[model samples]
Target chain A: MTPASSAKAPFQNKLLPLMLLLPQLLITLVFFYWPSVQAVQQSLYIEDPFGLSSEFAGLANFTALFKDARYVDAFLRSLFFSAAVAGISLSLSLLLAVCADRVVRGATAYKTLLLLPYAIAPALAGITWMFVVHPSIGIVGRAFIAMGIEWNYLLNGNQAMGLVIFAAAWKQISYNFIFFLAGLQSIPQSLMEAAAIDGAGPAKRFRDIVFPLLSPTAFFLLVVNIVYAFFETFGVIHAVTSGGPSKSTEILVYKVYSDGVVGLDIGGSAAQSVILMVIVIALTFVQFRYVERKVHY
Target chain B: MRSFIAALSLGTVLSVSALAAPVEIQWWHAMTGANNDRVNQIVEAFNASQADYKVVATFKSTDYTELMNQTIAAYRAGTAPHITQIFEVGTATMMSAKGAVKPVFELMAEAGEKFDPKSFLPAITGYYSTADGKMLSMPFNSSTAIFYYNKDVFAKAGLDPEKAPKTWPEAFDAAKKIRASGHPCGLTTAWVTWTQMENFSAWHNIPYGTKSNGFGGFDTEFKFNNPTVIKHFETLNDLQKDGTFKYGGRTTQPEGLFVSGECAMIATSSGFLGNLMRNAKFNFATAMLPYYPDVAGAPQNSIIGGATLWVMGGKKADEYKGVAKFFTHLSKLDVQVTNHQQTGFLPVTIAAYEETKKSGFYEKNPGRETPILQLQNKAPTENSMGVRFGNLPKIRDLIMDEVEAAFAGKISVKQAMDNAVANGNEELRRFERTAKN
Candidate 1:
């Protein structure tokens, strides 16, 4: 909710901005607050999946989560997954954005091809990756096995985790690339010309001039990618690992889905979702408070 | 012209009424592919048999858990289908949900439909019955876990094509011999916990959990950490160490291994027979599940694994009547026999089974009789009845997770079973707490 106080979009009538903002505010209230309140209400009770019975046990659900080692493990695993996905996608997208920025011909084709994966659903992306890496039937999987590496992701926790991470990051990279490319293009050509006149190499120009300018976009993407990896990648995990091979790829969101939707542990699932919201809120807050200090205008 | 116009209007009115329009009974099932076709065939047969009722079947989902979730949601919303296929895992959940379902026995009785509980096979129907032996759900496509191996691979390994390994030790020894004969994997199983753990416990007459495998009460605890189950896992672990046994993830993924002939043997559901008939290019055969010979009262009857038709609670009285008629039609010996033969699901009624047997179906289709024979091998004991606990899908997943850890050598067999029991008991306790009814 940006203020209408900015002179660029100032209104003669003071209430006009509020009138325009009503629709969005109403949407936020109905969609966001309603479900959140329901989750909080549900987290307090041991409710039946079929809604047949319910028992109120204040804070018991939250306490049970703390006592469960698997929940703790899942929390740590999600933290690692979010960090890995954010870091990999941001860095790779930045590199691709730089290369694409330098392209004089077929720029639209390259950009379109790179962005194509973003349009693919997370579940489809996961399935496509599975088709390429299935140990028995996949092309790369067969090659890996032929090279004497055991390639079964089904039995190996680490391999399963790797597959999910790759699928998730692969799908996310295009969004980051689009933003980075925009940021790159927006940097004035005079700055690069000035750097070239000062005898800066291409590498030096990028490191010293380009990267600092793109820091704001990178920081924005960092938050988006972290949130995406933490919450939105459940489909990828479901399609590929399904939190299996000893729950190696079982992130917090996936656990919530499994417990709530699949396992019918309504109270536990609500408690987990509540915790997930808290974690992401705290994470975004910490990032804006500290990490944002490094971002340029 | 006026008379002609009046006659035309009458003809239109008559066609619109369509002879009192058959009552539409909605059936939601998790069947897909060939099984989906079989479901439609049954519906078509039922619709054609009578004008009073027309059963319309909807493919809810291929995954039973998702279908149950949908059914629960639909029931809560008051938009539930009249009849939903509840898999064996959801039986305890369905039983516990007092008002969520209209028990088939009660429905039949209320509708004045002739339902002889004795007509159904004891082993198949017993799992869906109450302590007083009152049938709760109508058993439709119940299947039991049985052993299967490629007889071609057996011949190649210099073993008898007709004789599948009957004992656990002999099975492992045969696997070792098959490995020595140059196959990369000798055995793999689908529905890992179902074949190796749940039914294994039942087949060996070992307790899977207390209180008759959660049949008696909600206070039951898992007893799968016993020596019989642990020893079985230990043998699997050793086999894995030597590359004789390959772990094929969870349910039905290892089916591919068996079908592709990558793994020579598999222990999975009798329901897999249809898939095997279509996909398997080799000469495959079935046998009773392997048992530990040293255990007392070993090789007891195995348990059923498919699904039953649950009459969901809250529908019109006439709708219930239609459901009753459909159930009666389904239980007819001809329909049941055709279903059993076509889909490899065990016939629910003994009459249907006897009819199939009398037709010399077994002589022509060798592996088809294995599931029925195994289920009726003996009177089901408390140990051999079947496992039934609320939130069973979660419990099974927990057990499979532990078992996978054991397969990976990350944990010992005993530790895995112990973890599974402890975790399973906690889940059971959670179920007990949340579902007071």
Candidate 2:
């Protein structure tokens, strides 16, 4: 074939792949990107959907939110919640994945048990925890009572926060573990063998070879886990404490949900959504720019 | 080939006939537990009573607010059901949907259905009607706040269960006794904003706002931070400090606590009576909510708490007729009495109340008449009538947020209430600019 025909042949080869990707691209734009843009636009307008009336409020909703101290408190609480979830889930999961990677047998069994929580729906996970920790009916509460611990979520803000945080971490560990397991298995075992032969200790082998290989995976999972912590566990929070006994467990996403869905302040809710998106986007951008680069891979 | 053609034609004819069944009126509601069983019974009775209509009831899950949101989204997409049970606070939101909703009064009038708005309890139907008494929606399970106490627990605490507290001071005494008796929870409340603030404003005959709490116009301002409210919250704060009162989160039924024997006393909607009466193994007694004895016009009246059935527009004319017929059937006295008996909602009509009384049901069930007496003890003032402000749902949220803040000791009750009032006024103004004529 001539040079021009050869170049044209490559283009022809890629045509099928491009066509195959079109449907997913369309779906993403329609379901995700389009709604995201609309949510931003909606933040700028007060809508009475029942009356079909819309008014341009020009950042008034955001202004009002800034003035509302509860919003600020919730935003700050969310930061702590997201960080804790990311720190706890990522660290525990990495350790679990590493230990399982060393196991010669029952790896699959251990993994199946560890990942079982991920299979359970987040809502169900929340309810299960609620039953286990309910002050009157929950097993944990019963145990606490028996031990003479005056443990009541309805009165103890610290205990309420601890319970919600534990529930969130419990539900998220499975997700992180699964990802970490896949990442651990994908690592080249030869590198570790080479490190071991060089008289490097287990810690040195992990530091030089295993950890470096896992960094890229860890980085990706960090972003996913943070986003999940910020948004996905609102269901759990809602089912468990409902942002109570004193709004101790109230996160930004739960506030947005209550304001939008329960309060029926669509514009206010949209403003909260916009704020949440900005936060997550900023965190994600920073991660991509800084953390991703730090990964040796 | 000849036999195959014959079979195809026969199947087509049968399918066409099967598709010709009565148009099913789908009702989506948030009733569960014993209430769910009651709803099923009602739907079965209604369906069995008529040959031309089939009323199918579907439990759409908990969270009435979420249910309303879903219904609104579905309505926008032109896929809402024929009827939906919206909580009382949603009345204004539904009313604002001019073309999206069909007034039940007009439907009943046009269909020549025998109905009188006066037949129902004024306190219940009045909330769901227009200014001139045109019924906009059908009242299904309306309830007002009542005080419930565990008699056995009260006796254990050395308080007379037969003579329940009639004022806040008395209530505090009882709560202290119960707490001193070593119970973890002495007293708790549900729907704090609704029960303690909105209904409190009415029950004490205090003005909740100017413009009759937005019934007259969209320029209504909140008066939640009034002196009575301040005093009440101060009392609650003191109780909290003393470990005698627990704010059981917004909309968390304290009735469950009473039934579980965790709490000795609870103030909750009378609608929860069915749940407690059926589930509570302990002896319980219901009483009217305690008030401040010193306040002028104290103990005026309590407002409604249950949901109403709003008829949405953009339906087939036949469907509108079907919905109207269903409303008429639902309004019958016998049906209303059955509804009241099963759900513990106050009978929406006076005739139903009379019917319920004449049948000796209230005699058999002592607490059955508490809600009626609470509603009919005094005529409602402008504030005693239910709140109808635009963005009131948002206001309720703000109030609850502040209340929770107060409970957390994050802010003084006065400061929280003041903040809520200001923030709620801003929301009201925004709503006014958008929807007000």
Candidate 3:
């Protein structure tokens, strides 16, 4: 290790990290955390859905939420969606990251091309897929019809679920790939050089040195991706299927929206939001407290 | 400190003078495209016709659903518009808000504007009228469901284009023949719940729900899962499976499919006539929605499906007066006739309809009078009064979800309707509990 570089690394960690993270932390508190607390408060009460004349009803809302089978079914569906999205996104992103790391030329262009889908908003992503998969209008549906294979997603529950998962995974893979690329680039090249000199193969280098160093980034991406699946991808669900074909795409956040915005049941909507927050916070806390320790970096 | 006092007094003087200026009534609505253009034209005409009041109309969003959401949010913030156009579905919600709304009768009386509820059409006006026959909100654009068919498709199918289907069996046969003629879309319906369940029951003289579809009280639960509704949903599901009927998703927007020449026949709001008249390239015809053959008085009256203008609270006396004056201007027979003729919405007033009739407008147009005739056929039954349930939007989504399940083959028609009824009852109970205190 270079003594001078080692000396500077501690200085960057001491006060610099906090300074760099301050703006983001403040923004998260204001925009995300505050509204979340309000959502919890609103949920534990009887109020107009439009946020007026709210009176406390204690745990009645929570009790009702538990009693409704729709809530339970929707919660389970959200778990499936989030888990499927996180697992698929991580696997695909790690594969892309590994492939890109092996390449010696045009890596910059490859990284940009791979991360492009992440730049599209979730709403637009849903619309883009809807165009390509719509039974009557979409190209894929047309091709299936031409083959005399009746492939209307509107009537097929399995196909609808598959399309939603695929679309969500496609959007998230780009983001995970970007983060993995950064983590891969940060690993010391000297370690890899030494590994090659020690008669270690590419697979051994990746397994021994590279993967261990990337664990922290992988953990971080897992938490972020799961949270994204829970909250951010709701726009996709709303745009494409609108929890359609018999509530097959009805996730937690979509139910919250449907209850609050469309159903005009503010209290019920708030209850759903509070439950969603708990699920997200529990998963996030688990990732940070338990999963973070496994990372070698 | 002396200069600050002088400046404060000066500002107070200027503000007082501004308050003494002509009243401006701000209206927020969800009219867009051609309807938006019509709204602007009407507001401009009203403003030009008056000098003491200025009416400012704003096109807030694309559809009534979104606009209502925003309006409710705005109302919560105490920054709501002087007038908000709430859709027919929102009527119960708006009315349930207690002191949030000002009855149109009171607004007119306070403003010294002449208002007579008897002048408006019985079917359209009764939707927003209070139990004692006072108008709660001014009916802006009223519409009822009607059957629309493609004449070209019917001719190609070797069916008589001159005669429209009068019974459900006939419609089913026509749909099959039309699909057999090579058109992918045979028969499709928009607002499947509203057209096929709610209005369908009303038109066929069948009970849609208990307590007169919630119009009698807030305690109504969904009972459309009964034999008639089950039979109807089963017929639709069968046709959907047989490739003769397409179930266009929620809301009355089948104009897209119809205009694109995809669907041969559709049942949607009479309000969509403007869009179809402007967009349809092929010949089209309109008829009263088909009824069941078993019911003795099957061809019952259809209910209205447009929006009404509710005067919100927390406004000044003069502003309310201005709102009332504007409402009076909007309710004039001539203005109602113009709005109906230009936008294809049903005239809110009997005089407006008679005036148009005497002017030979309906005679020249022919199908323009079908909605009025359908709405005026007989005394509206208990089912025809319209749905008015607290937390109706939730009940609506429950129905939509279960119905979509039925369409997707996940559940049978009977099962879906049963689920919808159970879920809707749960929501109603929840809403009833909330409304109690």
The segments of candidate 2 whose C-alpha lies over 4 angstroms from its true place after superposition are A1-19, A57-73, A103-107, A141-159, A185-190, A245-248, A274-294, B1-24, B37-56
lDDT, model 3, position A248? 82
The sequence of per-residue lDDT tens digits that candidate 3 reaches over residues B173-227 is: 9999988888888898887777887788888877777887877777877778888
Ranking by TM-score: 1, 3, 2
lDDT of 3 by residue, A1-297 (tens): 799888877565568888989999999999998988888877788876444356789988889888888889998988899899999999999999989987989988998899899889888898899889877778987888899887776657677777888889999999899899889989999999999999999889889998888888888888898899899988788777778767888888888888888877777788888777788779878887866576655
lDDT digits (tens) for residues B281-354 of candidate 2: 88988899899999999999988888988877888877777777888778777787788777767888888788
Best by TM-score: 1
Give the lDDT of residue B114 in candidate 1. 97
Winning candidate number (lDDT): 1
Q: Which sections of candidate 1 miss by over 4 Å?
A: A1-30, A281-296, B1-23, B48-52
Q: Tens digit of lDDT per residue, candidate 1, span B278-301?
A: 899999888889888889888789
Q: List the residue pairs that clash in candidate 3.
A: A49-A266
Predictions in order: lDDT: 0.88, 0.82, 0.83
Q: What fraction of the correct interface contacts does each predicted structure contain?
A: 0.73, 0.52, 0.54
DockQ of each: 0.64, 0.46, 0.49
TM-score for each model: 0.92, 0.89, 0.91
Residue A12 lDDT (model 1): 74
